[model samples]
Target: MSETSSGKPGLTREQLADLSRHFDEDITFSRHIRAKVKEAVPGEATLYIDVQDFHLNGAGTLHGGVYASLIDNTMGLALISEVGVRTATIDLNVRFLGAVREGRVTCRAEVVHRTRRLATLEARVHDDLENLVALGSGTFRIFEKQGRPLV
Candidate 1:
């Protein structure tokens, strides 16, 4: 799917809200690092993560684990949007390409495959300079619970 000039898909505000909620629940550090669900297509979603010192590593650089988490969350959110339900990560593979410093980062995820019980997604992390910092792929198992869903 593609984006419009506003950096969003052609979805209405309500639709965007619903899609954002699919991935917004697990994000508890909103006050420290702003997270925005920018878009959601049939099998894809984009998550924006603003950089802050709280996300830094011991070396004062952005943590690789943080990048991995962002990728995982974004990809899982994309799968949820596609499947219309909650899911749990079954497997994840991440590759770090560059360093992330003090700036905003964007994690883009696309669902590559979906089955009755599982979904696979690919994601990329880019720094504010538009440099690729990491790439990841993950699979999630769809769950049917009776309470609030995991994002």
Candidate 2:
């Protein structure tokens, strides 16, 4: 994929949305978590999930793995929307800022940088009340998708 004169991704927002919808259909864990693509534009994507009892930990709070998974997926979505290529996470750093027991959780991710084969993304998760709950950043190794999809 290439960038436009303004440095935005070549794909339009609608195109990104379509891609996200396809991902939501093809990815099982994403669907199982009920994560939905709220909006997508250029190098950024927003996803949200409604908290459920099953999403809670034994301590009755939002599980840390939920935050990690959302952050990972959100960041990958941002990079994929920007570059239109397959990527694998190289390193991910997540910080648990606050805890949430219920309500919608939204994650906003943006592509911070990219090169020929590497990209970096940052994401922030917020509760329905708009309080920052978690933060994440990751480096991804961009690569071409092979002939067939993974089984």
For each candidate in turn, the TM-score is 0.79, 0.88
Q: Superposing all C-alpha atoms, what RMSD in Å does each candidate have to the true structure?
A: 5.1, 2.9
How would you encode candidate 1's per-residue C-alpha lDDT over 19-92 as one tens digit per residue? 67745655575323557777766567888877788888888888887787788778876776556566789999
Residue 111, candidate 2: Cα error in Å is 0.9
Report every candidate's CA lDDT. Answer: 0.74, 0.82
For residue 35, model 2's alpha carbon misses the true position, in angstroms, by 0.8
The alpha-carbon deviation from the true structure for residue 68 of candidate 2, after best TM-score superposition, in angstroms, is 0.7
Off by over 4 Å in 1: 1-16, 29-33, 144-151
In model 2, the clashing pairs are none
* Highest lDDT against the true fold, candidate: 2
Superposed on all Cα atoms, model 2 deviates from the true structure by an RMSD in Å of 2.9
What TM-score does candidate 1 get on C-alpha atoms? Answer: 0.79
* Model 2 C-alpha lDDT per residue in residues 58-142, reported as the tens digit of each score: 9999999889889998888887777676779999999999999999999999998889899889999999899999999999998
